[model samples]
Target: MLATTIYEQGDHRWIMFGRDPDKAEGIIDTNQYLVISGEEAILLDPGGIELFAPMLSAVLKYVPADQIRYLFASHQDPDIISSLGLWDQALPNASLYSPWLWEGFIRHFGMERIRYCAIPDEGLNLTVGRIQLQFVPAHYLHSSGNFHVYDPKAKILMSGDVGAALEPGEPPLWVENMSQHSAHMKTFHQRWMPSNEAKDHWLRRVRQLDIDIMAPQHGRLFKQAHVDEFFNWFEQLSVGIALR
Candidate 1:
């Protein structure tokens, strides 16, 4: 697994971990994010159970396990939070912030030690160290109940699967060119994303924010002009083709 610091300023920083070369074949690749502000840190979409060992090992290089006070899951997908049980053991006192609608379902992954702070459908705000993170509602873009993290201070949006891709093998961490990268993302979005109405709402909400970087839970990061390019492309693409 590779760990890269996507952003940093003072004690506030963002680290992205992914591109596991030794990962077992047949499993889809995933990206996990860590946001640290002073003493507290939050892990986002920490990946599946199979990725637990390497993900934990990579995270330890930056912050101690105990310092990870919070865990955020965009939805109840297995690849997104199946490692909940292992994480409960690792961060015994940490709390998980996830969709309230899936509390019952997510608990099946195991939640004896860690507290579950269900995020209401309207979403909510959380403060860690010096930064305030907003859990923005993003329902039906793929899942019945989902949310994405937005950091006003950093001008970054941890956009879950909104801009995800299914690129094969190892790819660069950042998207230097959208023309080449959009193809990898196109099919994934049209198939997995199920609601055009949901997509449009999310686009409007995000456009209001001054985003500098849009980081998804899979593939490369979108920055600067590429971020705008993503918005333009996604706004026009007609998703939920399976239903058609």
Candidate 2:
């Protein structure tokens, strides 16, 4: 797994870990984000069970295991937070912030130690040390109960599966070209995302924020102008293809 600092400004930093070349075959690659704000830190969508060892090893390279004070899952997907059991043992006192709808379901992954902080449907604001983060509602774009994290200070949005793509091998960390990248993301969004109404609602809300980087759980991240290009493309595409 490769760990890269996507954003940094003194004690406030956003480190993305993914693109693991040694990952087992047939398992989808996923990105895990770590946010550090002074003495506090949060791990977002910590990947599946197969990734726990490498993910933990990669994360410990920056912040100590104990300093990971928080965990945030966009929804209750196995790929999204199946490592909960392992993380529970690692960050015993850390709290997990996830949608209220999935508290009971997510707990099945094993929550003997970590406390669950359910995020309401309306979303909520959380402060980690010196930085303020927003849990933005993202229901039905893919999952029925989902939320994305937005950091206003870094102008970064951890969009979960909203911008995910399924590629065969390791790809570039950031989307270098929007037109070419659209092909990679098209099928995943059309099939996985089950609602056009939900997509519109999410687009409307996300457009209101000033975002510089759009970080998704799978595939490449979008930066600057590519971020706007993504909105323009996604806003017009019709999702829920399986129903048709």
lDDT (tens digit, per residue) of candidate 2 on 1-244:
9999999999999999998878988889899999999989999999999999999999998999888999999999999999999999999999999999999999999999999999999999999979999999999968999999999999999999988888766688889988888999999999989999999999999999999999999999999889888999999999999978
**Model 1: residues with Cα > 4 Å off, grouped in runs:** none
Compared with the true structure, the alpha-carbon lDDT of candidate 1 equals 0.94
Local accuracy of candidate 1 as per-residue lDDT tens digits, 1-244: 8889989999999999998888888888999999999999999999999999999999999998888999999999999999999998999999999999999999999999999999999999999989999999999868999999999999999999999989886788889888899899999999999999999999998999999999999889998778989999999999999978
Q: After superposition, how far is residue 119 of candidate 2 from its true place, in Å?
A: 0.3
Cα deviation at 102, candidate 1, in Å, is: 0.8
> In terms of TM-score, how similar is model 2 to the real structure?
0.98
lDDT of 1 at 79: 93
Candidate 2 regions with alpha-carbon error over 4 angstroms: none
Residue 244 displacement (Å), model 2:
0.9
Every model's Cα RMSD, please?
Answer: 0.8, 0.8
Question: Worst ten-residue run, lDDT, model 1?
Answer: 168-177
Task: Tell me the number of clashing residue pairs for each predicted model.
Answer: 0, 0
